[model samples]
Target: MTAAEHLLAAKSFAELRGSYSGALFIIASGPSTKAFPLQRYADYPMLALNGSICCLAEAGIAPLFYLCDDSSFVRNRLPLLLQALAHAQHLALSPRVVGSLLAQEPQALDGRSAYRFERVNRLPEGGEAMSDRRFARQARKDPDFECDFSWFRQKPNRIGFSRNLDKGYFSSRTIPYAGIQLAYHLGFSRVFLVGVDLDSSLGRFYEQGEQAVKSRLDGDYEDYILPCFRLMAERVINPGFQVYNLSANSRLPAEVVPKIDLDQLDALLAAS
Candidate 1:
């Protein structure tokens, strides 16, 4: 069966929608995340992306959800990935990853780690094309222009082209974008992003020290990162949903999503 058919066949998949509410913290594997005050936000639900699990594990912070779409993650870091999966209540991953895991360990997906396999369609719908056109127009006016994304207020059936995950809930350029979409689908109104540095040069915090992995920040900002945030700003934030960036050294522009300091989190949580 196809991935979509497999998803449709799974009884738990539909029920997984909107399974979580209230505030959410997304932890990406950036170098700056090492300094985040994890003790402050320890109580909130967190979604760990990629190798961030290693750092969170070291800090004794168990994430509620773990999301990884890249098959390379499984190939290069299967042990770490499985260890995270064993702890996470839910896992959003590609079907290929699931297959690979089950092959190595037969009991990997035996209802132990709630698995939600990804389904995607590469072709763009008309609405996505329009968002792309609109973004392009705005970019032509100003190179660093950030789209108002008010169009998302109308609840466009689709959000954007290029890097947006609206079409099939497929991963765009980064795993965190997919994590953001999953958070929204899980009914989270307030989302806080931690460790999303978006800078490739600094490398990942988890990979630091003697055995460091090479940075994957070679992609162009306009072609990869900005489009994903633009979609989130439109589809997720413009409609009154909140997303805050907590990475102090993050390369994401403030106009895309406002950044909040770790010290300010107490006030932010109380206000929520």
Candidate 2:
């Protein structure tokens, strides 16, 4: 299908609101994911991110929802992205990713159920004049920068977790945050984050050496990623929308997202 046709076929986020009321898993590309038992959740809905779909393919299962927040991956690794999209039951792509796919392979999303979401660009709340100037310059230069600056114009210039995805989602330098927001929009009660190890030294489980994708996690962790999770913990994650981390060794503090082993996860699921 052509990109225009794909757009015509794409479903709106509003259609997905409150569609699911059960537990779901978000598979990320952390090195620890190599050990995750994906087959155990074959019957359950799983959301795969970036190259993490390789793990799902290895388990001979397809992801219920697949998201690629990075357009660079679609440009640099089109084959892998296409491979994942072929097996994914649903798609959640940024506009830039869709544009890249349109340029690379207009027919890629044929007959697929997809939802497109915009990213919220957050400028520092305080009078960080230098940072604001830098961001303005970068936004002016980058053609694919699809940031919703609506929050920036507000009085306090606040940034927090997006409970309603149709408005837009905050980009925390990690695609997992998008997945979590998508889960919330889909009405999931319990969300499991698998392979969310924030350590950049280990690299991804699916790629190594020259084959690995470049990472900005080390630089973005403290300033962007951690603070975003803390905001989510404070504002969004409640009994109704509980989020659990399966990656025990993740760099994220336990207070931000409670960590649990598979046994604990199973018990929680059983209890629910």
TM-score list, all predictions: 0.76, 0.85
lDDT comparing candidate 2 with the true structure: 0.78
Model 2 segments more than 4 A misplaced: 1-5, 121-158
Clashes of each: 0, 0
Regions more than 4 Å wrong, model 1: 1-13, 122-167, 209-211
- How far residue 254's Cα lies from its native spot in candidate 1, in Å, is 0.6
The number of the candidate with the highest TM-score is 2
> Which candidate ranks first by lDDT, i.e. highest?
2
* Tens-digit lDDT string for candidate 1 (1-272): 33444333333445666666789999998877888877667888899887888777776778888877777677778888888876777776666676566656666655654555453333322223334445445433442222333444422222332222222353446677777777766678888888888887777776756566655556645555676677667644754468889886678887788888866766877877
Backbone clash tally for model 2? 0
What lDDT does candidate 2 reach at residue 232? 81
